[model samples]
Target chain A: MVMVPVVDYLRLEPEPHLCAHECTSCGARFFDRRNACAACGGQGFVDAAVATDAVVTAFTIVGFAAPGIEVPFVAAILDCGGTTVQANLRNVTPDADHVRLGMPVRLTTFSMGEDTAGNEGIAFAFEPAEQGGNA
Target chain B: MSDDIYILGISMTRFGKHPDFDAVDLGAQAALTALADGDVAMSDMDVIGAGNLLGGPGGFGQMLQKQIGQTGVPVYNVQNACATGATALRTVIMAIKAGEADMGLAVGVEKLSGAGLLLGGSKAADRDTWTPSGRVGAIAPTDGRIGTITMPGVFAQIGMQYLYEQSYAGVPLELFARISQKNHAHSTLNPLATYQKELSLEQIMGDFMVAYPNTRPMCSANCDGAAAAVVVSGDRLATMSAEQRRRAVRIRASVLTSDPYTEGCQVLFDVNTLTRRAAEAAYAQAGVGPRISISSSCTTASRPPSWCTTTT
Candidate 1:
């Protein structure tokens, strides 16, 4: 069986970390490919490593979802250094007390599922770092 | 030769589930009614613009023409997210401003009777098996995989962010419920609004939670609706009947905007910035801003409304 990062920016090798295309002109970092910078309209970009550790800027315990998708998950806005990252809070109880503003977390990954061709998609998330595993 | 544009007439279909009628049917009803309201026939329209999001792959303008009349004039189809209707209106306004057409028809229609979550055209994530699905997930969207690429989750984040930044007076959950309560109460006065009956504050707070800080009542109903307006140049209105001229509402200034660059907008989609920028520009162009009105309900108000604290 072979494993691959679900998203292009997620690098599974060495450690599960995020990479951003930083605008060379304005220093604005973003995931995925960008043709032009939104900040300065700059076309040039360089690869910048995202800090694995992040602080919870905002979060919500989602109670509803679409078909085939489960509910009661915590969606959060994480500050990876100065850049913003969106991910679900894993390995923690999905509630108000479990997740809060200014909570510290680190990047983590898990198996999503395997296809008929035996290609497993690995997805990344942030776990509470300051409180061991589940805070 | 005046470049000013005025709404000759406006009409809206009853906002509710039109299971029997499609989006085009709704659009046609509004368009025809608006034309009659202006006391003008379809032949008087010089151009047409239509906006429909989930109608189909076929553009709404041409299909709507089939229902109304085929004038063979310019047809512009707009698919802006929530501004589809506003964009269609503006499209007609620009045609009048450019001196291309004296009178135009603008229609915005959408059929969302059973629509689920607004995912911004992203494919739903498959939970059981790994497959190439939406941009956010191949296998699954949840399970701590990534941030929400959905609208409900985005609103939840916005509300929480507001509470965190500002020392608000009310509880975050209660405040969000109050916002929904205010909207539901206003619907009672609007005969065309869907679900005109008001829900008590307790019912709103006790409803099922769609997202944190947001209940099912807070979210907009996925009902089919369409609105159309007849727009004409100021000079054209003066030449029309005195009744048409008297009923016309002059549009002084309008501003439509998309997201501006903030590094955060790439992931979370910053709607707050867009509204803020649009409001500021609108005030400058119209030479007016919010002011206390001498309504019978409130004679002396010291503080801004609750909704004002959220944006500002």
Candidate 2:
């Protein structure tokens, strides 16, 4: 299967991990790079790997979407070891019974769409960790 | 600090779709209206600042100048997302404060409808390697859904958290609908608003859902419009007739700020914090207190509504 990452921040090879840049001076983690640390104006940064295990901090059932996109999906903010990342909640229905705040989740990947050549586009999401499945 | 700056005139086009008008057209229309309101000729303008997010062809400010008869005055384009209008005003204020120009024009225009929706279409080459996920780029996917969400989804997440965790005066989700109703009702009195019909709470709640707790009525419409203001230095105002002086409005202060970076925890950042800080700074500069009236366009569910009141 030909796989490509949707964004550079999501590392899919070998193992799924969220990559972040950490300011050397202020220890602030960011999904984007900075010429200077926003917290302390530090010029240096170090690569940081965010853990896959996280909990849903906030979420919404998006009922509207662009053309050809699905609706009523759970769009959620995950607190992965204090580094919050926004993603979609998977393996669960979009309802109050299936989703709740502070639910444990683990990072997972799935196919987005395929080109004419059949190369699958990959993106990241989180599913209930208790389900215990391969990422 | 030679003399205080005052707004001599202001004008805005009706806030609705103008299918016949482009960005430059709307900008020129507003600019002309402002100049006429100020009773000043285009030749009197020493500098021009134009604010816009999306436009076509030539530079927005320069194109506006072309339509309004350019007199060799300096023209600048300013873009700061939704803050484009305020940034343009700030730019002109700084120019006049620095004694660079005695009379300046600031105008903001947008053709959001003309720009088709393509939110997550940023090219990979344009993507910042350091922050690939920072913009509209895709992320890890789950189930059958792509992991990309737009601005409304982001705010909806925040609103969900606020609803789940915070308890202030027992405010319910209905408050959002009520707020939308109030806004629509107020728009009835404002001929410029895109949606002027008063919406009942039921109507707002029953509207098509965009995000959880946010329906169609609760969100702003993407319409085409422009607004403009003419500012002059105190020295320039002194030369104007008594009628102009009576019509002038002083700009006591203008401040701009941004959110500080925090560890990825979205809940740690309160959107109101930045606005509160900016408001405090403006109040101090204008020698006003918290009790003073405020006028703002902030639509965040977490912040209370505020209106502006001029203090003499």
The numbered model that scores best in TM-score is 1
List where candidate 2 sits over 4 angstroms from the true fold. A1-8, A11-15, A33-36, A43-47, A111-122, A129-135, B56-58, B114-118, B121-147, B164-173, B265-270, B298-312
lDDT of 1 by residue, B1-312 (tens): 676789998999998889999888999999999999998878999999898877543688999898789878889999876777888888999999999999999999888877776562235434454554444334444433476656667777866766665745456668877777887898899898878979877998788877776777877777888899999999999898889999998877667787788768877666567777776776676676656211111010111123532221
For model 2, residues A1-135, the per-residue Cα lDDT tens digits are: 567677666777569788887889888877654677777788888888998999887776677665555777887878899787777788887765677777899888877666555667777788988855322
Query: What local lDDT does model 1 show for residue A28?
Result: 92
The true-versus-predicted C-alpha distance at residue B66 of model 1, in Å, is 1.7
Task: Tell me the deviation in Å of residue B288 in model 1.
Answer: 1.8
lDDT of 2 at B52: 81
Largest DockQ belongs to which candidate? 1
Output the number of the lDDT-best candidate: 1
Candidate 1 CA-lDDT value: 0.77
Clashing pairs in 1: A86-B147, A87-B146, A87-B147
Query: How far does residue B306 in candidate 1 sit from its true spot (Å)?
Result: 9.2
